[model samples]
Target: MLAKRIIPCLDVKDGRVVKGKQFIHLRDAGDPVELAMFYNEEGADELVFLDISASSEGRNTMVNVVRSVASQLNIPFTVGGGIHSLENIKALLRAGADKVSLNSSAVKTPELITAGSDFFGRQCIVCAIDAKFDKDSGFYRVYIHGGQKRTEWDAIEWAKKAVSLGAGEILLTSMDRDGEKNGFELNLTRKISESVDVPVIASGGAGKLSDFSDVFIRGEADAALAASVFHYKETSVKQVKAYLKQEGVAIR
Candidate 1:
């Protein structure tokens, strides 16, 4: 089995790293460059930097910020938010991002996913899905614009479609679980992971070490991403990996 990955997420708003609950009540985390360096030193398998407001603000991602953070990292990192075009993806790659994640843009024009994968390879394309459980509909609904807008797309269907369109990975974030620290949205993660052939990185609501193991073993996620717990020093990548190793989950 391939070793599972432990990733730290840095959600940036206005060029500063921040964290929030359910995508609200935002609080500053730290400098993006500093935090990236710390995670690199902590043995994180990879890092994710997302511009939380870029989509809603109608702008592109922070290239300078990406460059600064990427320069400090030894491990691979994924950058997302406000990435709409092939040029944008090229610019970010030029700025040092190993992968570019598309959310609203991919939904708006799925051809971008196909085009990007064709031009940059599917490995460079990551489809990010921000989903929330709808109690009435009994399904997970996809959200975009940094979780500010709702879409009719069902999360599972979207994941399969994206993968078919050449998205090599899925960065699945559960808005309902964001910052809840209860655990990951295992049902949602597992459903999507099982439905798609591409790797799925489970995001949101990582509170304890076991949450990582649960997502890997039960959810069958390729990777697990956390924000507040790692940002505030509640846990470390080493600690999570140690626990997962103890649980018999393969880890790098």
Candidate 2:
């Protein structure tokens, strides 16, 4: 069996890493390059840098930041946000991102997924879904533009469609559970995990060590990504990996 991965996320807005609760009330985390280096030494399986700014200026700013962060890490690195075209993916990949994550742009132009995979291989593309449970529809609804807009697609269907279009991984985040510090949205994670063949990285709602174990075993997630828990000195990646090892969860 492939070992479960533990990843630290850097949500960059203006060339600086930031974190927030449920996608609002943002606060500073730290320098993306500094955090990247710390996590690399701290035993993190991978690092994810998200350009949450999603602006033309921000995208350019992120390229330089990604290059700097990439230089400091020996582990796999993934970058997301403001990725709309094949050229955008190319820029980040050239800047040393192991993979490129897509959300808003993919929703606007589904072909980008196929194009990205065709040019860079499916492994280079990650489809990130920010989902919120819809009581009326009884399904997890996909949110785009940083959870500010709701799409007509259901989270499960979108995951399937993205995989079909050549996305090799699904980055699933529950908007309601984001920064809630409870646990992952198991149902949402499992549904997408089961629906698609690609690896699913469960995001949001990770409050404690047990949450990681639970997401791996119960949610059936291939990996777990967290931000605040790792930032602010709440828990180190080495500590989480040790706990997972003690709990009998395979780790790298």
Candidate 3:
């Protein structure tokens, strides 16, 4: 069996790592480069860097910071935010990104997924979806631009479409649970994981070590991505891995 991946996410803004609830009221977490190198040495399965404000600000990725972070890591890392075209994807890969994640760009032009997959292969493209619950519909609604805009897209349906369009993996974040440190939105995670054949990365709401195990064993996520819990030293990657192993979840 393929061991489940444990990923540390660096949500960046202005060249520094930051975190917030529902993607607002941002607070500084740490320096991206320093945190990334630490995670790399600490047995992180993979690393993800997201220029959290690029799309909303209507600009390109912060390349300098990405280059700095990528240069120090031997582990594979994925870059996202404001990736809108093949050119942008190529630029990021050239700067050392192992994979490129697409969110609002894919929603506006899904053909980008095919283009990216054609140019770089499906495994090189990760489809990131930020979703929130809709009480009226009793279903999750997909959001974009750092959860600032709502689309008509159903979260589950979008996951299926992304896979069909050649997305190799799904990075699903539940806005409702994000930064609350409660626990993962297991039902939403399971829904997308079951709906798609590719890997699904569960993000948001991981408070304790058990949260990680719960998401993998119960939520069925291929990987668990968290920020604050790891950033603030509330938990360590090594500790989380030990707990997951004890709980019978496969890990590297």
Quick one: best TM-score, which candidate?
Answer: 2
lDDT of 2 by residue, 1-252 (tens): 679999988889888777533322223235777667767888989988888785678768998998887787788999998888899899999999999999999999999999999999999999999999999989899999999999999999999999999999999999999989999999889888998999999999988889999999999999999998877557778988999999999997
- 40-150 per-residue lDDT for model 1 (tens digits): 777899988888664544244378888887777778999988888899999888899999999999999999999999998999999999999998998999998889899
Candidate 2 scores a C-alpha RMSD against the true structure in Å of 3.7
Compare the candidates by lDDT and give the number of the best one.
2
lDDT of 3 by residue, 54-152 (tens): 453323436777787788878889998888889988888888888999999999999999999999889999999999999998889999988999999
* Each model's total of backbone clashes: 0, 0, 0
lDDT order, best first, reads 2, 3, 1
lDDT of 2 at 103: 94
- Error at 202, model 1, angstroms: 0.4
Which 10-residue span in candidate 1 carries the lowest summed lDDT? 20-29
Candidate 3 residue pairs that clash: none
User: How do these models rank on TM-score, best leading?
Assistant: 2, 3, 1
